[model samples]
Target: DIKILQLSLRSADLCIESGTLDLSLKILERAAVRVERLEIFSGDDDVPIGRTLSAKYYMLRTLLAWHQTRPDLAEHMLCMIPEEAINNDLQLASELADLCYNVGQQAFSKGQFDLAAKWLEKAAKHNSRSLNAGDENSPNVKLRLIILHMTVRAYLEQNSGESRTKSLQTLEILISYYPNELAVLILWLEVMMKQGNPDHRIFYNRLETLVHVIELTDTNIKIILSYIQKLQEWSIEMCVRTLEQLLLRMPVLSDNEQWIDRLFVISIRLSTSSGVADSLSLLDAVATHLYDYLMKPLSQTTANASLIVRLGINP
Candidate 1:
């Protein structure tokens, strides 16, 4: 019976190849019935064989749906395909990734961003699974990056705080893997500004450090300035702290004429508009307290130290 089913599957495959989709569909329906029957009587040795047959059956159905231009159905069939089947077959995995990406794009174009993000994330997962050990510059890597970028875009287009938070989480994961990635860093900063959080001073410090390492393009400079503008409006003290931190790193960033000029302009604005001269003492006091807490040893001036010193007199 299994042999008969195998032959039937081959016939169905050939019918599909010969462009007889109707015939192939009929044969596949029969094969699907037989697959269910096989599962019922499947023994230990027949289990893998049964799974292989089921995988082929699902794959053929997916292809048929794709051929008919029914992407929604095709995606459904692909979802039914077992993970073991996909992992064992590179071609199947590639097909899955391609179809998911196309479907995601279609959804994105129709303004269904939530659906788009779902499929795009699927595409990214499958595409990344195929990465080779030394293929950093390979086409697959580039494709994965594009997929992830689109995923983030889809999440952001919803214009809700929840969606922006999702985008930030995605960018955070991306930055962990590609720390010096210019686009990821810029997008991360943009999302931070959109979130309107005043606790982004640490991230600003990180940005200053990144500038010393990665060359800032004009676009990067523009986004950084926009972020600063928003931060200044929201919390001038944070903006001042961030500017001071960047100023400390000026020895390295000063080589960029555009950046240095912008930094000086911002500093002048702070000095002129914000009474930065008067607040210098307050900032200095806060800085000293932080420095002493972080740098100075507690044991040196603690009661424990006095007790230890007095022990020698007692003994």
Candidate 2:
């Protein structure tokens, strides 16, 4: 049991660093097995130590499994967490919220919009309650709320006509309440584009405001750059699509020379950083496509080259 516990802890640390949720859950299950074995060996006589440990193990295992798969199960387990379990157990509560957030995310990924909404709403409410009760502010809680807003926006994207109008109204409400969430803003831009009725000027203005509000200190820059680099590595197509959307929408953005220059530099850097020849070649092709748009005369250009450049396209 001790060996399994040590293995689980090590795996959890690695998974957390690498974002390997599935592997982490598998290790956690092993730990849970050991905990169960220990409980059985200690006898089911309702001893205080055994019961307490059982509850703790069950909570952790349930949370970990939920993070990997069905969140509803996690929610059920959350209700079982003893009040005594959380008296000084900030870690336990935080873990529960994190699991709930993952459940919401899994539902969103599976396109179970209603279920996703419910789970996310519950997670957000739980986090808020914890915060209001003077629990330490968990960054995970804020992140979950941001994701919930994003999922809500995504759900609205599939509707049409009157339903679309209703979705937009709901999205606007969410945005109004979480105005400072960058992920929400980004998703809102995406939703607007998907609707084919984006207010480009307003969107760009908001993005600009967000960029300014974000600190550009060395540490912040490093983190932002790392994120950009990771995205470039993991999903070049996404980067290209984002650029394409920006170009298609923001006309005045082409006039932003500084932003355009920075984007070009970033693209070049990313292209070179990618060691794979094929990946670099693909990036080059994207650069060329972007260039064609940028070089076109403003009178003839249907898309904004400057915006593309700002998004790390060469053109």
lDDT of 1 by residue, 281-308 (tens): 4344333433353353322323232233
Give the total clashing residue pairs for model 1: 0
Tens-place lDDT per residue, model 2, 1-315, is 544555566666567457677777777666767767766776545444554555566566555656556566666766665656444445555565565567777777878766676666666654544453433365755664565574565457446465467567757766775677666665565566555545555555555444444544445434444434434434554444334333332233436444444554555455545554454455455556656666754332222433443354444
Q: List CA RMSD, all candidates.
A: 12.8, 15.4
Question: With candidate 2 superimposed using the best TM-score fit, by how many Å does residue 258's alpha carbon deviate from the native?
Answer: 11
lDDT of 2: 0.55
Off by more than 4 A, model 1: 1-71, 90-95, 131-141, 160-165, 209-219, 233-262, 277-315
Model 1 TM-score, 2 decimals: 0.59
Give candidate 2 misplaced runs (Cα > 4 Å). 1-55, 64-75, 83-89, 132-138, 157-177, 189-315
